[model samples]
Target: MQRMLDGLIKFRQEDFEEHKALFSKLKRRQEPHTLFIACSDSRVMPEMITKSLPGELFVVRNIANIVPPYKEVHQDYVATTSAIEYAVKSLKVENIVVCGHSNCGGCASIYLPDEVLNNLPDTKKWLELAQNVKKRVMVHLEDETDEYQREWLTEQINILEQIKHLLTYPYIKEKYLNKELNIYGFYYMIETGEVFIFNYDTGVFELSN
Candidate 1:
């Protein structure tokens, strides 16, 4: 608590003052350019990683960075979907990034047995959105035994899945098809500070260097 308080003090005294003009401009309204959907993991700092300033990225973080399909958006309390909708339909963000990071506990949790998952109750239900992620990854996992590689592959595939989910929205799909909006799938390596971007045409996650 004290550490957070000290950080807040510094932000108000130093960082905020340095960007006071920008903050004043953003005080009334914000017009961020991108909608950044990413994991709720503490290590994945969207602003810091992208070197983005305030009013630059509208961010939504959730477990596994899951995006429920458009058909299910009608369901009650769909926070993630609602954020995506507002960003596209209201904010009119030009780019959407679904980012997943290395060693994500949420992605790994989906591989647990039903009993284990059920123990988590709400988490289990939320992760079921990614059940097919397990099935899709299992096919190519028969011969691979390295835990590290397996982890990254799952995280990368999870990013891809969420990107697909974003397109399920009619507005997003229409804008995407018309080339008015751009959606990206990003997989970050936390330890090495590396990022791989998904290539829609090549069907690969190429390094962002």
Candidate 2:
């Protein structure tokens, strides 16, 4: 906490002062180009990963970076749906990137014991949205190596699933079909610092370099 506070102090004294004009303009309003959604994991820093500066990306971070299929029951769609609608309809972001990373603890949590999952009921339930993702990957790649490759495959599949879920939103569907917004699925490998983009044409993830 002290570190963060001190960093803010330094920003106010130095960085913010140096970029006063930029900050002054940003203080008025923001028009970001992309809506970047990723995990709340400490290791996943979207700005650093994408080499973006302040005000460049509008971001939403949640455990597993999951976006539930739009629903109104019990107002379950409150947070995720609101963010999606605002980003698309109001913010008017041109691109929406659903990024999933390697070695996601949320993905591995499914293998946890009952006791563990019982304590994380909400997380467990949210992750259940990816049940089809887990089933599809496990069955399709049963013969694949059980190492980084498999983990990467799972992460890639999760990103694809989230992208599909994004389109399920009525507003997103309309915008996407009208070519008003573009959706992308990205897999970021933490260890290797590589980003693989899911190619809609070939239905495969290829390193974006």
Candidate 3:
């Protein structure tokens, strides 16, 4: 807590002061270009990773970076969906990036035994949205015992799955079909500090260099 407080003071004294003009303008309104959806992992810092300034990327971070199918979204848990709706309909963000990172606990939690997942009731329920993702990953891992490969495949597949969920939204689908919106699946490697983009054409993740 002290670290955070000290950081706040430092920001006010240094960073914020240095960007006073930019902050002054953003104080009134924001015009972000992208809606960046990422996992609630401490290592996955969306703004720092993208080098985007304040008011540039409206970010949504949730366990697994999951987006429920439009019709399946529940009234009790509408945080992610509401953010998506507002960003698309009201904010009119031109781009939406669903970022999945390496060593994702939410992705791995999909394979957890029922007994273990029982303690994490909400997390378990949230992760159910990606159960199909586990099946897809398992099929690809046939006869392979490499956990690292399994991890890599799962993370990338999760990103693609979230992208699919995004399209399930009527407005997003309309904008996407009309070429008014662009959606991207990003896989970020924490160890390598590298990003891989899911190539819609190639149907595989490609290094974003």
Candidate 4:
């Protein structure tokens, strides 16, 4: 808490004064160009990774960066879906980027012991939304080695799966079909500070060289 407060003090004294005009303009209203959905991982800073300034990207972060499919169950209007609807339909964001990162505890939790899994009830339920990814990746790669490479590959596949979940919303589907909004899937290699974007045409996540 002291560290965060000290950083705010620095921002107020140095950064804020330098970018006074930028902050002033933002006070009127924000017109961010993209809705950035990413994991709540400390290493994955969306603004730092994208080189975006303030007011450029509206962001929402959640465990595993999962997007639950639209459903009408009781008390179903959750934070993730509500944010998605507002960003796409109301805010009229031009693009939506769902980004996942390496060394994600949420993804790894799936392989954890029962005692550990039982401790994270909320995370467990949220992760089930991406259960299809686990099934597909496991079955298709049954003989494949369970090395670090496989985990990274599965993580990228999960990003695409969540992207599919995003499109399940009616408003998003309509805008996507009309080509009004572009959706992207991204993976961040935290260890190497590299980012890979999923190329829909090639059906692969290629390094953003």
Winning model by lDDT: 3
Q: What is the C-alpha lDDT of each candidate?
A: 0.90, 0.84, 0.92, 0.86
TM-score for each candidate, following the candidate numbering: 0.96, 0.91, 0.97, 0.94
lDDT of 2 by residue, 1-209 (tens): 99999999998999888878888889878888999999888999999999986788999888888888876554554676678778888889999999899889876675568788889888888888888788878877866657565676677778888998898788888989999999998888898999988899999988997
- Candidate 4 lDDT by residue in tens digits, 117-202: 67878877777776788776787665566657657767887899899988888888898999998999999999898999999999
lDDT of 1 by residue, 1-209 (tens): 99999999999999999999999999989899999999999999999999999999999999999999888437468788889989998999999999999999999998789888878999998998998887778876755677776777788888888888878889999999999999999988899998899998999999997
Ranking by TM-score: 3, 1, 4, 2
Model 4 whole-model lDDT (C-alpha atoms): 0.86
Taking every candidate in turn, the Cα RMSD to the unseen true structure, in Å, is 1.2, 1.9, 1.2, 1.6
Question: Better model by lDDT, 1 or 2?
Answer: 1
Per-residue lDDT of candidate 3, residues 1-209 (tens digit): 99999999999999999989999999878889999999999999998889988999999999989999898556686898999989988899999999999999999899899999999999998888999899999898965678888888988888988899999999999999999999999999899999989899999989997
Please name the candidate that would achieve the greatest TM-score relative to the true structure: 3
The candidate with the higher TM-score, 1 or 2, is 1
Q: TM-score of the candidate numbered 4?
A: 0.94
Candidate 3 Cα misplacement greater than 4 A, ranges: none
